[model samples]
Target chain A: MTATAFAFAPGDIVRVKDDWPERRGPAHIRTPYYVRGVQGQIVRHLGDFPNPEDLAFGRPAEPRPLYHVRFKKGVIWAEDRADDALLVEIFGHWLEKP
Target chain B: MNILDTPSDRLLAAVRDLLAQKGIATTAEIQERIAITDRASPGQGARMVAKAWVDPAYRARLLDDGAKAAEELGIPMRGMPPLGVLENTPDTHNLVVCTLCSCYPRGVLGYPPFWYKSAAFRARAVRDPRGMLAEEWKTVIPDDIRLTVVDSTADYRWMVLPMRPDGTDGWSEEQLAAIVREGDMIGVTVPTIG
Candidate 1:
């Protein structure tokens, strides 16, 4: 199946989608908890790939653009002394223009 | 012995047995895949890095297409995730981590170090990378240099192409490869001239 095209590009500021339904029990989720709702900048366009969330359940994945999202150290941690950066691979579906 | 098996290990063995029973994959094929993993090591990565240091065209290729560049060196990359080579420079340093799971470039760098797969490293590498670098790995980055941590959470796996150490101008590719540690490729430390 053709993958859904992504609108956002590298250098775009984005916020993680925080609307996932609350898990009833332990589930195989790829999105990290700390990044949900956090704002970050897209560092690179990682091209299209199968959505890993569906792949975990042995289902066919609809491909989506994955991006390397960069969050400043201080943004993630309040007490961080350095202004270093962290890049997380996030699927297009989990991000929105902020 | 059963107590020693982790849940994942037991699950893998069960899956393998079932697959074998159904004639989906022969035991030899399973063993061969395991052997391919075993044969992979840091030496394979070091050779690529060393070659890049000497050959500008090859370096460009390495950065442009990591898996194809590896194939130029006869590295088997089939069934592995796409590889991304991040270049380290005087102004920028690169570190790689997998926040969601232990996704790594096993085709080139062999098995990851124990810490690379740890919960603590996964979290801290993205949260406070500079602190983790100094306190845990003993590698210090100058304040002027920008540190970019690449998270290998998707289909593309990443490895750092570290800056060649100074004073190694006359060194052979083999000699250069010797000093390029697995940690250096992982970006926890820089390759130093010794």
Candidate 2:
């Protein structure tokens, strides 16, 4: 969807260019258990990742890009995966430019 | 100065004031419900697994989204955001640890279990996982299976989905749940009680 579609919500897809080499967790606010340090592209933008206005107890403001990062289950849970393919879609901020 | 007037004491006073205003039954009720337990404490996640093993829809939702899945079971996740649950099938086993800090799903799972927040467990788990398991929790793993320890932190929360134990074709939901302990949910122990 167009960024305009998001009004001031900060919408639009951007590719992950890189990740902090020494960070503890992923870059996103709400990261997944197995998605740390994983690389992927943003397929779509879901408004601002956490618009300030939508915050539980914070000032009203658009958060950040919350993209959908797709990963093969094989890459993540492959250590003991039963199936050859396991597909998962996680949020955008979860990824860094990589 | 009034106890309620101090700045540092304001938050606690406010809580007391609110409780008094509502005529809340007692501090015990509040304590029992709001107390923080270790995330990996002995039987924390065991409770959730017990709940899910008996409830089909709950199990499906847990497999889908652990945060909402937890809410459906009446677990409150106020401070803990972005919860994710992982399932362990016969072929795969999942373990959780926070190498950086003790970040856990306290809202749904309760306080971080003692072993979770311990420095020894933290340092040794990352260095020698197999040894830590055998020595600390007394968990023994076979040589064939692969083991991966997940790290929970500021941005993410994790839970393990344990494989269903065999042999009980017609066990009641409660019966099955009774057997799924917290250790199983953490990947240190398999579900054998039920």
Candidate 3:
């Protein structure tokens, strides 16, 4: 399947979407709660793939962009040391300009 | 069959039988698949790491594309998620975890350890990696070095390229591979001369 164009480039700071399935948790979601609504810098484009959220339901999924995001220390956890960072892979649909 | 089979074992039997009834895969075929997975070991990833240490060009290829590099070394990477290599240096350290689930580089390093899939490890690895390393594996990240936690919670799985330990200057590729361990590649422990 053809991949959708990348929305954010490397080094761009993007925020994760806070929206999640209300009430009970959804069956599948790649977006973790820790990074939800948090801002991180784009490290690289991890290539496009079918959305796992849709693939879990056996739906026809179009390929979408996924990016490697780097979050600094104290952003996710307060006990983290200075200059320490966290890196995560977040799909494009969950990211936006911060 | 053992009467002590857990619910998970019963669930597997049911699925296997159903699949066989539907002609999806025979019992023998499923057994072969299980054997293939079982045959996979940390030695495969160790071989790649040792070769990378000896060959700079191969190291570049490995950092560029982990799956292709493993394929170059005769390791099949078909039907696995994209593999990413997080490098460790003197100034920077990298640790891998799956906050959501155990999204591991199983094709290369075989199955993940029990601690990797534990809820406690997942949470602590993200919130207090420095402490987690120090306590669980006794691998302390010094203050001089920067600690970077990587979450393999998505499709892209990861493995660490641990720094070559000191006092192993003239070691051969095979010798280097011997010092590499499963935890070393997982960033839970560093390779020691022992």
Candidate 1: where are CA atoms >4 Å away? A20-26, A81-83, B1-14, B20-24
In angstroms and one decimal each, the interface RMSD of every candidate reads 1.8, 7.6, 0.9
TM-score of each: 0.88, 0.58, 0.90
DockQ of 1: 0.69
**What fraction of native interface contacts does model 1 preserve?**
0.82
**Residue B174's C-alpha lDDT in candidate 3?**
94
Ranking by DockQ: 3, 1, 2
True contacts kept of 2: 0.00
- Compared with the true structure, what per-residue lDDT tens digits does model 2 show for residues A1-98? 43234232223233333344337642323343445665433433333444322363465544454443434334554443322222223334444443
Ranking by TM-score: 3, 1, 2
CAPRI-style docking class of model 1 based on DockQ: medium
As for model 2, its CA RMSD to the true structure in angstroms is: 7.9
Tens digit of per-residue lDDT, candidate 3, span B144-187? 99988898878887989998988999999999999999988888
Local accuracy of candidate 1 as per-residue lDDT tens digits, A5-31: 455867789998886544665355666
Best-matching candidate per DockQ: 3
